[model samples]
Target chain A: MLNAQVEPYQRLRENLSQRDRSLREKVMTLEEAASFVQDGMKVGIGGSTMSRTPMAMIWELVRQRRKNLSCSRAITSTDGDILFGSGVSDHIITSWFAQGILWGLSKVMRRHVEQGLARYEEWSHMAVGMRFRAGGMGVPFLPIRSMLGSDVMDQRPEAKQIDCPFTGEKLLLVPALNPDVALIHVQRCDAYGNAQIDGLQFMDIDLALAANRVILTTERIVSNDQIRRAPDQTKIPFFCVDAVVEVPYGSAPHECFGIYEPMLNHMEAYVAKVNSDPVEGMREYLERYFYEPKSWNEYLALIGMEEVLDASQKGRSIYND
Target chain B: MTDTTRYTAAEILAILSARQLKDGQVVFAGVGTPLLAATLAQRLRCPGLTILFEGGVVGAFVEPGKLPPSTNDQRCTKRANMVLGSADVLLLLQRGYVDIGFMGGAQIDQFGNLNSSFIGDPAAPKTRLPGTGGGNDISSLTNMIVAMKHEKRRFVEKVDFITSPGFIRGGTSRAESGLPAGGMFRVITELAIFGFDEKTRRMKVLALNPGVSRENVQDNTGFDLVFDEQIAITEPPTEHELETLRSIDPERMFI
Candidate 1:
């Protein structure tokens, strides 16, 4: 006879496959996954600026018209910039702001900041990532020596100065960044959410496990067998993932390691487009590239899969030069 | 054959910065000129140089003919030995594993403190440049080598803001300030190379770049500089060095 009084919350914590459950139903459409994001939630994004960023997820969030979102991360690529430029995000916590010297995509954010339309608080990469690390470990704060002599200590509200208990040396403490949701883009992920990132984790793994909810977007979706075969490659276990979305070329214009190289020409065009006129240019860009596309397949069709495949070939070749 | 080549100031700066790197040294390099210099060193001078990028690539063997757009560009990890998180890179810096931290800045004060945070008051007003990325992490923990274009505006008596620690008041004050004991070692500019004096910890001329006079260096600098007993002229870039550097960055994106 089943015990009818077994509390659901208690049963969930005591589940047998707590860490190794089959989360097949966790897979959802990009729009559905994006619905998990609420307005005014502090969001953390994966990847360094212009490198393997979660562009598709960001676009979905913007398309959904989620407003008043604030970003938390070590650095952002076009992800944070586009969000702020499109009026999706109003504030950001980061260190680096420049787009790649090759592509000045973040010029929009700069314009917004200079105009006082958006706000930003800066921290060194170490101090910023350490906050995510502390959050993942369920700690209140993490100690470091990096921001000791920088202006970041004075600006960041969470950055505190504390004396070492034993050594009596002054150290900087970065508080944990417990974001409401974390959006991460990776190279491959299984339906059950055992994900693998090929190159430069760059705080993604930390951000994935740290946030209250993790919505993972991937370049491709693989089977559970493939994930089990190389469990060691999995950076995020299924238990940590709240939902997953499969979107090919998810980090377009930004390279997904071992898949495609960042398209410098496309990025340059983006910068030029926005730089010509920040407000009108972005609206036109978003309309043409994001709003018009009804689905992921349509977006890729617009991007032309041949160009992507060629770039992928070049990226895979170690010495293409 | 002795190769004689007339190089631009940027090219000359890259070569001079490359020459400072020792074989088998671990270098933490930022983007722009520093990237060009570190790659030049790896290809031309130090084959054993291990390059670390704050974006998480370690022991990166940057591909020729395709200069990475940023330190974290996919090309940086293409031939990397290990791809780590930014936190791991900082841990390595904290452990004192990185030998040379090559960087560039908008403003550098007499004490070598760099300011890339903002141009005007902290509250508001004026220009807001990109704040320090790994500037604080690298400058605070490693022996730093700065590369910048020499101008009176960039070389200031005191920076508007100390975005990253240099000498911190030009004395034991840096150590006294509870820092982990690492600061600037060399300042490579387009016109001349500068170093910190051991006694007073002030900017001192180490070498003058080709065709640049002592007065040219002084006129461009915002602060008074100390001079070594004998400052040598910086060596002109050889044809091989120029060709190698050009091959890496054919477009001269940052040069």
Candidate 2:
């Protein structure tokens, strides 16, 4: 006897509105908000190759000397090799690491690997399978195809292949990686952390959904009603996001399309310097870009806006223009 | 003869340059020799042959002497026709967009199964190495799979592990899997070039480096040696090819 007029699933629909309300209130600056990442936490970052990384926050963390800050596990879809090469990361879970090529033969990441400064878990793309599956299922581990035939399995013996009783085919068992926090940079986000990622949404949705807490750093922050007007455009809804930060031109030096152009010539010079004398060059880069600056404004001042813009224009001429 | 005892890196570069390529053909460039092949293909054979990097840049144009240190070089973005995501690259590979795939290995068995994962034991690897990145997918899908490796003891009869499916358990099962449908195509070494039998996909010596003997080639490989009726020496590099290769990547001589 179902009550004809009574709605049984009213609570579920009502809960959606409340969740949306919570998302509209929490917003801050990237520097002000990243402090939420406490010591001994596992953090996931969103980007692929060199696109869409929270470069500003990464530089800020380096500037703060957030050394050995107690983060045990670091995960990303692509190896943010430059971040690792800069000495901020300790343990990494990724397929490959490189500066200009694969595996950081450019000396930035090579020096770290050669010197044993960082520990890493090298897996094939199947590792992404484990993470994404865990994020979707809300589970901690999943069985995957055996990559044991490759060098990855030999390097990380713990990620071994065991015989499946049902099929007898060897399957590699991977531990699910659900990060405590995930920091994502996007094109636009509302004050409540409803984010819109325009192009090539590289693992951001999976990462946003997988993390227990989500911090979004966006180039622009729009009003709540503007987000609600086109709800489908929001790739990450308010329910999944914990905080939002407004960061104009956030992915500087690496380009964010309409926001900033890539600085190719400067990037080339940096790459050359890093490749030749990594330790000294990295120290100089940190001093010039991060440590010497007291605030984000000061850091911006160090690499003048005009110079960055000029570099961007030059890059556009070379690449896009 | 003493001067020709070892095939210099320049000779290897020249041999690669002589290979023919067509426009719009997609070539998957791996880290070392493949990189050289791509650069050579650009310089001599087919300037418009689309160069695909596993890192997801397509139709990349690296300057002759300005070879990037790694695949993720920002220069790739500046020089690329399109920048794709890693997953998209995998999709492209599966879709048969790539024509040729270049790969390298430490050990290769009689069947052409490559091992780049370990030198000693499976469970407890004494010396861990860089494992197959996307070589598995590239090997399976590319129209032709070209293997390039320096001839040595470490690369022998039975590989420690099969990193990429070359000619698995003969060729019947591989064809059954609906893989590119062709057998393994070519194995290029510093000393010579080897081609697989059309049906068996078994290695058959096709050519030798100048002054290199069949015995020396057999001694270096782990499998039983097969010799062709007329094994020709590879053509020596012209002055231009040698100059281009040396000018492009002088540092890689050590590797």
Candidate 3:
């Protein structure tokens, strides 16, 4: 059977189309990567809450003055606040939105949504993931067991309840959430864009495949040989990655797993200032942390070497002190 | 010796909630009181208990001085047994793997229904809180222990919105509404501990904290609280428990 089809297969092969599967370089500067994002696009942020959130890329987007972007994350955090505060993203779809889970609810997020400056949509953690799962699988929606008897379904009209054809039990269907751009931060990535995450992967893998484009901000860009040394650690392959930018401490002030812990002083200061006053506090913060810094290094300098080392030591658990 | 007599409301909440966790049970815990309670349980009582965080860290280890600010905090994963993806961990919570869910929310009703969604009317919310993350799924699938401050505003007659269903209007309603399993097992607060009456599923006092008057609990509660004829008085925190708790949180951030 294999040998007989060779003549007809060649003609069919010539008619078939393909995307570039070659190992081409996908490196780009943060500014260049930020260009791939546009207004009104559904931007998927990788990472949960504070850990490994792509704050640097988000900061760059605000600096570039992108507007009307719809953002989604498995769990939202202070980045959600920045998006609303800067008017970079007018809508946020997330499972949880807070500066820190223990810091109480975000007054910044509350002020924006309550005042009608932005729209906030909430989904159960499972529903958010299932939406991404459906998006990655190219399905319209996925069946869920939760949100069956709650106000969450009532709020989001997109979610529908139906009887399962197989089990004849009730199930809630959540629509696929395919973002226009997925911003993922990784522990390391090769220049060819095989990204590796050292700790909890969260939903970034599904998000990378579901989005139209994947832009990765990495803590370090290692060689392909280094990436290949432990191929299993590379959760997102080069094929899935469209662009990669190596920016050390990319998740600074937010923990990057084995790299560094959250810079508590920076976070606390921001939270205090913002809680005291929303508009002016956010504006001053944007100027100081996002806009005024000429370079990423300058921003890091503002965070200071002392806090950096301290956060790093805390993250690595290097000492008793 | 640590002063056990003057334990704060947070300390009492953690202590009471921690006591409910049994050994070898798999607990799905959120940040704040839940994590602290589970950690205290692991340290003081249930060493076999496996604590998992919402953001996919399974068998999460809680360092004494470093209680994470969020479930997804890197500290939650330092010595974790497995770091699954978001879907995988949430699936575990959905499929009956988790035994007890430890959580905190904005409001809870007489029937133990929780509201983390909004405070005032949905049409015009006076204060909008963070919406349900995994609160729905966790509450739907496993027994839950709620830890909250005992205030008139918090112990509401009815939640503004049901972000997590408890006994849904009491009785067999939650099950009749097509939920598989799980319901609120205990409601631990600073004033008293409550559990659902098996018949009515309404909040009934299981125990009262020492020195808190019966009128005080009823006065602080928005709804009429059901109290047993022989309500047990909660013992004050032991010297050891106080010392350990203080040691765990030297800065007293969550203590």
Model 3 CAPRI quality: medium
Candidate 2: tens digits of C-alpha lDDT, residues A243-267: 7877765665555543454554556
List the DockQ of the predictions in order. 0.65, 0.21, 0.69
Among these predictions, the greatest lDDT belongs to 3
Q: Quality of candidate 1's docking, in CAPRI categories?
A: medium
Flag the better candidate by lDDT, 1 or 2: 1
For DockQ, the strongest prediction is 3
Models 1 onward score TM values of 0.93, 0.67, 0.94
What global local distance difference test value does model 3 have?
A: 0.85
DockQ, candidate no. 2: 0.21
lDDT of each: 0.82, 0.60, 0.85
After superposition on all C-alphas, the RMSD of every candidate to the true structure, in Å, is 5.4, 8.0, 5.7
Interface RMSD, all candidates in order, equals 1.7, 5.7, 1.4
Q: Candidate 3 residues B1-255, lDDT tens each?
A: 113557888888888788889999999998788888888888898888899888888887688887787888777875678989988898997788988998986789999999998989876789889888889888987899889888899989899998998998898888766676899999988888899999899999988888777898999999999999999988877778877777777777776
Q: Which segments of candidate 1 are over 4 A away from where they belong? A: A1-24, A103-105, A304-307, A319-321, B1-5
Chain B TM (all candidates): 0.96, 0.87, 0.95
